[model samples]
Target: MNTGSETQMGIIPPLFCIKCGLEHRLPILIMTAITEQAIQDCMTQIRQKQEPHHSLEIQKYAQLRLMDFAPLLGEWGIDDPKNTPKAKPLPNVAQAFQAAELSAEQKSKLLNYLQQAAKQGSTTAMLYLAYAYAVGKFIAQNPTKAVECARIALKHQDYRAARLLGEMLAFAPALASDVLQNDVQIAAQNWVKTHPKLAQNAEQIPQLITQYLHNPIVAKFVAKQKLQQAKTMGSPIADQRIRGLSMIGVLSSSQPARQYQSIENWLENQLAAAHMPIESDDDMMILPEHMPLMVQEDDDVPVWHKAAIVGGFLLSGAMITLLIIRFLVK
Candidate 1:
């Protein structure tokens, strides 16, 4: 009985007004029926894939698998379409950096690409540019520019940049007085404003700054601090920095010596309880010789526990003395 747009079963009925039972609208009626053949024809057209021209499109396609578009492809009835155009691969930050040794024109081209990517709001590109500026890699070192780039990334809500900025503020002596004189604590305070949980305790600010100062970036800063102090003051620990970095009253502690001693005692007690020798040779008890002398400055000390340095010495000394007394009696 159905003349137009027949499904496998039958023609679909047109929507009608329930109360009036008015005759069906022609356009609405026409739209009601969709046959299997129509679906197949629509799918055939969708399967006729066209290649993309834009570089961004190509990059996006290459980075994301075709399967990611499965839902859209399915809806369009496109499957296994060929000749999906791929864009030429852009060199990553590392590649571009290494290619700095190439000819001037080539390097310049690469730098331009990176700059464009940064301008386009690529956080990765911004970070690489920041690093290049910070370390003088393939470009004249400019810490100010590096900091600026890092700040830009932070504005974009990049947590890596936030941590990096923290490191720069805490460790970089070039920035210590000029930029970070009061900024470290101020920055932390600002951060705490939004992330209120970080400021739940009174000690959180100092604790957070301490963690930042312990980052790998601060290693160079700590070493430089030690060297400068050793040359001028002839004492490494005499300076307040080794006590722990402080600015604007955050991370400033007067009792680092006592705190360090307590840590040393706790670590020694733990090791003694375990009966583990402090060094490879079980007989040696001279803790100072075995333990590193560069305590405050050295960040990469082999001992995992900060207290272990002093604690190991005391524990080893006590053990050796006991052994010596036993030998003398024998």
Candidate 2:
């Protein structure tokens, strides 16, 4: 419905137009807001137009609307010549990222704008800049600088920056060596301990350590602390090492199914030899089909002897009965 917001500053609001209806509200506002002289001139121009000028006239009206709302539009960072640019866009940094697809040159320009915003202490801008640097998107990879920027962002209680910083410190290979040189593991462990939430991210550290340990040049450094731990706690450390080695072997083996089956078979055999029911061996287990049978016999007839007599009688009787039946049939 047409409402007061749709009306021009001074004129009474018009009924909805049949052709364009409610869509013309802003245009109507532009029409009314223009000076009377401009309106007269516009009317004259339209009257002088021929059939070919309809599209041009519509374009002119659109341009006029833009010009009339230039200040408000510019305030939203819209750069239309008719509108003013907003200091920041709605939804702030998120909109800038969405516009990253505009063009390489445009993205660079946006980066500069975001930098200015960051300088003015926009936490969102700082965080975005850090992300751009961290990933080397539109900027060279500068993890140290990214960390610095992220730290500043975090000062403003930006959880996104805190999370990113924690992640970068936890993983990023470019920073790993320097971090380790500075005893960063202890620092990270301390951070995780103090911030219980960050501790949950500790899983990422083991992966980085594994990566480091796989590198021949860096393996010694990676193994130093683990070796110390293993030396200090013998059996528990040995068990952990065994499990770790087994997992690596399983993962690295080409024939995973065969390897798993072998492991399962070994486990089952071990359990069976130990007189323990093999409840399960990784995947399947043995289950009894029925209750175990119990054997009993009178004292006068030893159990074994009684079972043998029963078997002999049944066999002989079956043979004799078969002979008799055959004779009768003949």
Candidate 3:
């Protein structure tokens, strides 16, 4: 055994630290049998000391590795805490496919990964895959799949998915399967009931209405519902549009000439009766002969002031006319 090489020593098994779940390979072992609680306490103290460094590492990884997905997530307002290794993790399959830098093979691989993730019940992955299917990003265009993904997201409480579903139902109803048609209708009806209270919500309502107007399956109903909604909201412009849409069939038929004329006349009267926009204080410019034009500081100018100015102008015009007439007579 002592022939030439040094005598071999037994190898020690790695010590698994229970607290931090890391294995420690020590070259030497102290015979002292430390309690498991003592080991855990020691590990916990070590981890506490290393927490800041670990956080720094995670932050660096997210900032450096996930820069591409940052803007995309910010746009969606998705909350992605840096607690996990994933950053701004949302549905980005379509975005990845559409990126100019990815090769065909890379896109294929990425798509496969996304599909797997989606199937594993990743809501964000599903949403992204749905859009990819809808637009035929890297895969063949499949509206059916897009609708399915959107429905799944909606079922999972993604309100934005409901919006996508509403849009598909309203603008491209033909693309929906017959089995899903009634479901689409029901979803759309529910969507119409939404009352927008935020700035973003208000902005999205008009887009939804536009899609509803294009829906061949329920154009008339959509228009009618919008008309009522706008009226309740006190929007004159919306009222005008809905009324015009309702008359499309009547205006195109000679048999409904009277109805068309009646509707036209009513519209005209409505427009005439609507008040003109009053000039705001900012818009009201008053100029004195010797000074620069001064905008009114108050929101409203006195009605009597306007009346007095008009009367003065009219009186001056009458005086000029009377003098001219007298001179001609003379």
TM-score of each: 0.30, 0.28, 0.32
Candidate whose lDDT is highest: 3
Tell me how far the alpha carbon of residue 186 in candidate 2 is from the true structure, in angstroms, after superposition: 13
Q: Against the hidden true structure, what lDDT does model 3 obtain? A: 0.42
Total residue pair clashes for candidate 2:
7
Off by over 4 Å in 2: 1-92, 171-174, 177-330
Error of 1 at 264 (Å): 34
- The full ranking of all candidates by TM-score, starting with the best, is 3, 1, 2
For residues 1-330, what per-residue lDDT tens digits would candidate 1 score against the true structure?
Answer: 011234212111122222332222111212223333443343343345433332221211121211122221121121112211111123454555644366668757766876887787765566666666555455554455666786676566543444444444433422432223133444444444554432344233343343343332333343333333332422222243334344433232333332122222322333233343344456655443223234476557565576778899999999999999999999
**Candidate 1 wrong stretches, greater than 4 Å:** 1-91, 169-171, 177-330
> Tens digits of per-residue lDDT for model 3 on 218-307?
432332443344344333243454455446641121222221222222222222233223334685844332232346687877999999
Q: Which scores greater on lDDT, model 2 or model 3?
A: 3
